[model samples]
Target: MKIAIYTLGCKVNQYETQAMEQELSRRGHEIVSFSGAADAYVVNTCSVTAVSDQKSRQMLSRARREHPGAVVAVCGCYPQTRPEDVRKLDVDLIAGTGDRMGFLDLLEQELEDRRPMEAVDRVFDRRAFEILPAGGLEGRTRAMLKVEDGCVNFCSYCIIPYARGPVRSLPPEEAAARAKELAAAGYQEMVLTGIEISSWGGDLKTGQSLIDLMELLSDAAPGLRLRLGSLEPRTIDGDFCRRAAKLPNLCPQFHLSMQSGCDETLKRMNRKYDTARYFRSVALLKEYFDRPAVTTDMIVGFPGETEEEFAQSLDFIRRCGFARMHIFPYSIRPGTPAAELAQIPAAVKESRAARAAAVADEMRKEYLEGCVGQVYPVLFEQAKGDRFSGHAPNYTEVLVPGSENLHNRVLATRITGTEGFSLLGELEETP
Candidate 1:
């Protein structure tokens, strides 16, 4: 059988999709592009926002419509939260947010029997972390290890808590074992991803935390560059940063989740930390690491967010001076508490996003300029004509003009200039 998988949303979803692809390939099934012909189509969906939900639906619909004879499977947050909505789309197989192996079983069963299958369980009832294969398919430069799953922090604007369930962490030994395997598999980098990685050990009753997991993986896979996924602001402190800073292979890029920077806005969003606390996390990362890339995500024009609050957020973000930022116009997710509040007008939301983006772009340019003339060991991933591109330890994209196949090779490159958002570099030994 030939399977086509289309992934949407966060790195966790991508990791799960890759696990599915790997499993299917091992079962002697051919893995093909989602756009091309295939025996089945898997749509790994995301429901982080209204737009994400719409995209999930569109992709599922397209899979069914385009490949009418092929089996269509839908999984991930979309079906986990809104199974009925997914059922309405008439996909052949439906599995939600758990049991990757079982989901594959359902996919195979559907193909064999031509019977529809639905495997969505109540997400909140899930307690165990589903362990799937960690690495991607052949030739991938980087692999993500999902060391945690689910979220406990029920932010007013988030449906993920309901879609994903409570915090369930992959045991440290399992995660370390997988990290070692990835390193042995020739992956130069391994990303630790989850729904909320900072909340990793909450359910385990063990005193170990994310920093412990990082240290374990750092030791287990000493050769692999370990990077983290989006982290909670509360996760960073003197202890966390101090320990993380000592891990020589840990990438300096820290993507702390900051939906809104204003205290009142954060309060309404039910965020655990305020602007003051979040800033401390940023400050600690910068203080502990050398020019560490402090990145964040901001939601502009959240429900009931006033112009003053938006401006405050803008000002606060500027104060943080993030290396890179993902700015979003808040969209009402129907099941979330924020959806019941007074919604911001779409135009206003978009306008605020544009304004925030302008500020973020300026900060990005400043950060890129700071990278010039520095030497960084870049893990080159791909080549395009005379150029090979990869990323520095801070996750900054660095491109070097080279005819050699630098793919999967870490080379110390000297940054010569900035190319817009990316850095232009030359091999340190190049003439």
Candidate 2:
């Protein structure tokens, strides 16, 4: 069978898609491009926001139109929360956030019998973690290993907790083994991703934290560059930074989640940390790692966010000087606590987002300026025209003129200039 997978949402979704693709390949199925016709089309969906849900439906409709007779299987957070919504779209197979291996089996059986199947379980009742393969079939430069699942944070604006259930973790030994396997598979970099990596060891009583897992993975795959996904600001501390900085393979880039910089807005959003603690985390990371790229996500214009509050947020972000930021206008997601609050006007939200984005753009330019003339070790991933593009250890994109075979090799490149969001560099002679 020829299978095509359309992934939506976060890094965890991407990791799961890779694992499903690997499973299908091992079962004698051929993976094909989503643009082409296939025997089966899997739409791995997301419900992070209303826009994400709309996009997932759009992909499903396109798949159905493109492959009239093919089986359309839908899975992930969207279906986990609203299985009936996905079933209404005429999909043949519908599964939720849990039991991905079982989902694949049901999909295969439906393909053989030419029948429909719906196997969504109660997300809150889920207890065991679904372990999937960690790498992609393509000789990709970076792979993602999901060591944890689910979230208990229950942030007022987030619907992930309801869709993903309670926390579950992959045992430390299993995570270390997957890291070794990914490295042996020729992936130059690995990103440890999850719904909430900070809650990694809470399910187990082994006294292991994310820092402990980092040490194990560093020893398991000493040659591979290891990067982390978005982290809660509350997880960063002197102890966490001290242990993590000693791992030679760990990337210097850290993305601390900061939905709002103002204490009042953070309180409304039910964030765990205040501005002072968040700033402390940022300061500690910079003090430990030389010029490490610290980035974050921000939501502008929450309900009842006054001009003074917004200004405070803008001022705080300027002080932090993030290398990059994902600025989002507040979206009202139904069933969340924020949706029940006094809604902010769309025009106000748009204006605040624009202002925040401008400030972020200025800070990004300054951060890139600081990287000028510095030589970095970059792993080339692809070639375009006369240049091969790759990413540095800090996850900054770098483009340089080189041969195609430089795909997975790390090379020393001297920063020359800037090209949009990427850095332009010249390849230095190998020692």
Candidate 3:
């Protein structure tokens, strides 16, 4: 069987698609390009914003139209959140966010029986973390290991809490074993990713925190560089910083979720922390790690956000000095609480997004320039022309002219300059 997977939004979805691809390939299936012909088409979807939902619908519809007889399988956050929308589509198999192995079984069953099937369950009732196969089919240098699942935050603007259910975490032993396997498989880095990683250990009876899991992973795979996904600001404390700082294999990049910088806006958005608390997390990372890259996400023109509040947010983000930022103009999801509030005009939202993007672009350039003359251990992943490009411990892209076979090797690189969005550097000769 030939399978084509079309994934949309977030690293967790990508990780899930990769896991499914691996399992399907192991079962004697040929994975083909999404644009090419295939007997099965899997559309892993997202529902973070209105735009994502639209894209999900478009992809599902296109898959069905392109291959009239192919099995159209829809999965992920979109179907988990709004199965009714998916039911209207011409899909053969529908699986929600959880239960990847079960989804595969259903897919194979449908192939054998040629029956339309739906396996989506009530995501809110899920208690245990559904562990999937780790490592990606494409990359040898880096792999995303989903250690946590579900979010309970329930922010006013977010529908993910309902889509993903309560916090469920992979046990420390399981995470450690996966990391060791990835390291043994020649992966240089493994990212600890999930829906809400900071909320890890909340549903567990063991009372161990994310810090404990990090410690275990570092110990189990001493040779692999462990990296974190997006984190809640309040999760970082003095103890976590101290312990995480001691882990030599951990990357020094922190991505704190700062949706809105204005306190009033944060209150409206139901965020757990204020600007002061978020700044503290930023300060702690800088204090503990050596020149760590701090990145974040922000939503502009949220519900009931005033011009003054937006200005304050712009000012606040400049103060935080983020190395990179994902700036989103707020979009209304029909079921979310924020969608019912007084909405901002589309023109205003887009204008604010542009302004915020300009500020973020400058900060990104400054951060890249700051990398000049610094020496870093870059794990090369791909090549462009005669040069191989990879990422440093801080997750900054560093490109250097080298042999083509730099894949999966950690070479010392000294930063020289910047070209376009990438940092240009050269390989360091070690005596």
Candidate 4:
């Protein structure tokens, strides 16, 4: 059988799609591009926002229209939360956000029986972590290893808690094993991803945490660089930084989730931490790591966000001196508490987003300029034009003129200049 996968949303969704593809290939099926016709088309959907939901539906509609006879399967957050809405699209196989292996089996069964199959279960009822394969199809230098699942932080604007259920962790030994497997598979780096990786070990009685899992995996695969997915700001205290800094393989790029920088806006958003605690996390990372790339996400226009609050957020972000930031104008997601609250006009949201984006651009340029004249080890991934582009230990994209064979190999490069968000460099001679 030939299979095609169309993935939408975050790194976790991408990781799951890759795992499913690998599983199908292991079962004697050939994987093809989503644009190409196939025996089955898997649409791993996302419903993070109203916009994300619309995009998911658009992809599903296009997939069915393009490949009329192929078995269409939908899974992930969207179907997990609103299975009935997905069923209306007339997909052949529908499974929610659990038991991916079982979902594959059910997909095959539906194809065999030539009948529609709905395998979605109440997402809140899921308690066990579903272990999927790690790594990607291409021989890329980086891969993702999902060590945890689900989230307990029911932020007012998020539906992920309902769609993904409570925190369920992959045991430390299993996480270590998976990291080793990825290393053996020739992956040079692995990103530890999950819905809420900071909440890892909440369900465990052994008192293990994300730091424990990182320690285990760092030892399990010493050759592989370990990167983390979006992390809760509360997870980066002095203790966590001290232990993580000891791991030679851990990447220094930390993306702390800060939806809003203003304390008042954060309170309205129901975020767990205040601006002070979030700034402390940023300070601790810089204190422990050598010029680590501290990145963050910010929501520009929350409900009842006054001009004063917006200005406070802008100033707060500028004060943090973030290397990069993802700025979003608040989109009213239906079924979320924030959606029913006082709404901001589209023009106001757009203006705030634009203002935040300008500040983000300035910060990015400043960070890139700081990289100039520094020699860093870059893991080259691919060649483009007269240069081979890759990333440094801080996850900053570096482009340097090098041989095609440099792909998948780490090379020391002296930063020459900066072009927007990317760094231009040249290969440095060995000592």
Error of 4 at 298 (Å): 0.5
Give the per-residue lDDT of model 2 (tens digit) for 89-197. 9799989888888998999998999888888888889888888989876878898899999999999999999889999999999999999898888989889899999
Candidate 1 at 427: error in angstroms? 1.3
Q: Local distance difference test, per candidate?
A: 0.91, 0.91, 0.91, 0.90
Span of 10 residues, lowest total lDDT, candidate 4: 400-409
Model 2: lDDT equals 0.91
Query: Stretches of candidate 1 above 4 Å error?
Result: none
Q: For residues 102-158, what per-residue lDDT tens digits would candidate 4 score against the true structure?
A: 998998887788798888887788888888988998776899889888988889999
* RMSD (CA, angstroms), candidate 1: 1.3
Per-residue lDDT for 155 in model 2? Answer: 92
| Span of ten consecutive residues with least summed lDDT in model 2 | 399-408
* CA shift of 178, model 3, Å: 0.7
**Separate clash counts for every candidate:** 0, 0, 0, 0
lDDT of 2 at 342: 95
